[model samples]
Target: MFKRIITLVILVPVAIVLILLSVANRQTVTLAFNPFEPSDPVLSQSAPLFVFLFAALMLGMIIGSLATWFNQGKHRSRARNKAQEAVKWHSEADRQKAKATELARSSTLPPPAESAPRG
Candidate 1:
């Protein structure tokens, strides 16, 4: 809940700013794939400046995420190893508990039965 509030606080203004920026820069710009041919009809696209900005932002995010994931690979591996060990330990503990319970049951003697004769 606190995270949601903080996210809203941070994202709301950023969203508004992006919206305003896109609105202000609504003019279409031609992007040519071939730098040598500025007027290349086949290799050029006309799009708003915001489209390029947003595209760059998305691309950066994707690259950063991939880099972060790769950087944390060792940590993830360690966590997975620890989790497997923990599961093994838990199963061992359960087996020991079952053995202890069985031992306790076998070690204890049964109560003596009393038979009364009625007249």
Candidate 2:
């Protein structure tokens, strides 16, 4: 229930802003790919202003994500090392537990006599 509320709270505002951006930037704009040929463009295409805006937004997000990931390389490395160490410790513990069980079974013990019911 709390998750749903949080999702709605964040989603509603973002959806409204994106819708407004798309509506406001609906004008058609031409993009020229051929920078050398300024007078006679060999490659050019017209797109909606919203397309450019969305493209820029997507590009910025991708760059930011990559930069963040790259910057946290040390943290990732540390996490991996810690996980490996945990696995090693767990295996050692399991081996010790098995050895203990084996030693307990190896010990000579007399069987218990049957007890009569008191009831």
Candidate 3:
């Protein structure tokens, strides 16, 4: 939820800016060149205004996602490693506890030589 809000907060203004810029410059822009066509079209007319704005928005989203992933990559791996280590340590401790219980049960009787001599 927070992430979504943050994304919207940052992207909305950028999208608005791009849209406004496109709208303002629409008149000055011309259709894009087309080699297939006998005559190249004006650049602005070539692509719809919405298409340009959508492309820019998508580009921004991709950059934002990549940046986020890159930034979190190390921390994610580190957390995973820590969890694995914790599991390993717990299992080792369990094994040690089992060994201790077994030792206790098996050592109830003393060695014959260590037993008190008969009166």
Put down candidate 1 lDDT per residue, 2-23, tens digits, no spaces. Answer: 9999999999999999999899
Our model 2 lands, by Cα RMSD against the true structure, at: 5.3
By TM-score, how accurate is candidate 1?
Answer: 0.83
Query: In model 2, where do residues sit more than 4 Å from their true spots?
Result: 31-45, 109-119
Q: How does model 2 score by TM-score?
A: 0.73
lDDT of 2 by residue, 4-107 (tens): 99999999999899999999989898777788875454587688988988898999999999999999999999999999999999999999999999999999
Extract clashing residue pairs from model 2. none
Quote each prediction's TM-score: 0.83, 0.73, 0.52
Give the least accurate 10-residue stretch of model 3, judged by summed lDDT.
38-47
How many residue pairs clash per model? 0, 0, 8
Minimal lDDT window, size 10, model 2: 37-46
Q: At residue 73, what lDDT does model 2 achieve?
A: 100
lDDT of each: 0.96, 0.91, 0.79
Ranking by TM-score: 1, 2, 3
Choose 2 or 3, whichever is better by TM-score: 2
